[model samples]
Target: MTQALPPLLDDDQAAFISGGVSISAAACRSGGLPSMARATGCRIAADRRSITILLSATASAGLIDDVRRNGAIAVVFSLPADHRTLQFKGGDARVVPLEPGDEALAERYVDAFAGGLEPLGYPTQVIRCVLACRPDDLTAISFTPSAAFLQTPGPDAGNALRSGA
Candidate 1:
């Protein structure tokens, strides 16, 4: 039998996901064509086995298609005030409709994100414009991470962490 793979994400990582930071989700398809979308919110499963990213329906068409066709995804979350970042690679991705309850999560995320942006010199209006969206236009992509990497700007930026080992 094979040794079990390590847990893909930790509690700290999960906090970053749902802590109202900027998230960028990407998917690649045939011939390595890539598509990306900014996520308004992130929700980690209670079991810590997966993540759900909330994105705009209109802006994520290509990304949705890419995930459907390839089932491969890479999500990057970056803290604006500092360059600290993490990237998670996942398989078994799927796009789904966001439920009614997801809207509140999005609202909380937008507010927290804007608060974080203030120290970075982005005004409230700019934050609103960047994250503004209607509930009807929101969709979710869920996936289980198979790999995680620390991408904070430094010598260790590209290094895969303990989980990916």
Candidate 2:
């Protein structure tokens, strides 16, 4: 018999739901994107009132590049609750690249996520802005969320915002 997974903490509650799978290590491939139907699980933690994401990957170099160019990335995983899948929409954040054996790298991720960040045992090549996008574009499956979370406005918000009500 398989051991039961623990209940999802509040941090894990806000995940990207694609079809029914949760985006986790098992769902993501080494050098490719996860299926849209697969749920990508990630922790969106707050630090000093700023939100950051915690991603686990065998190799994130390609993934980081994908996020930088596309402004978004998809993570797939299976949820333990009902054995269904889900995906979490990760919005773009700052990317910080590091060299191998950099002890300070983990600290940066931890600082980003606020709560303690756990090491995934994978060598990180680069960190890119994590962006939020819809899951309806997944190859195997097509579904859309009722709503989407856009990137946070920067200082340019004043110039971008419209005055009409």
Candidate 3:
């Protein structure tokens, strides 16, 4: 029985996460060791409860396996220029196949990510190379955020995020 979780992200937070922020995820492997991976992109459901994060299958195999095993996941989104960051934790993660339009979404994410970095002195080509992935190697992890935190550096870094809008 899967109960629908209320969305933790408001409209503004949704928009921020949808943008080309840096995304990474972590899950625990056997013995509680952590597996981490860089996510290529993400999609927020219309209901604002479930968020699907795209990962490179080859690069994220360990993380994917951990998610499959434990269903516990934590993902972070951060803007390179401002250091604004958010962390979302969930205990109901699931690994799934990428839908048809996800490839385009990943490409757009890569473009926006590169644009965000170009102003910060990172070459666009270099940024693209760093996030490059094959379409066939793409996988998705979907989870409903049960907890949200402010991870940006400073006094309130680890505080629970209440509202941004």
TM-score of 3: 0.92
Q: Write the per-residue lDDT of candidate 1 for residues 1-165, one digit (tens) a residue.
A: 012654577889889878867899989887876999899999888877778999888988999999999799999998888878999988889987676679999989999989888877888787788778887888899988878889999889978875543
Best by TM-score: 3
TM-score (C-alpha) between model 1 and the true structure: 0.91
RMSD of each: 2.2, 17.2, 2.9
- Model 3 residue 100 CA deviation in Å: 1.9
Candidate 2 C-alpha lDDT tens digits along 76-154: 3343333433332333323443224233333333233222121433222221223122232111111111112222234
True-vs-predicted CA distance for residue 162, candidate 2, Å:
24
Q: Who is ahead in lDDT, 1 or 3?
A: 3
Q: Model 2 misses residue 25 by how many Å?
A: 8.5
Give lDDT per model, in order.
Answer: 0.84, 0.29, 0.89
**Candidate 2 vs. truth: CA RMSD?**
17.2
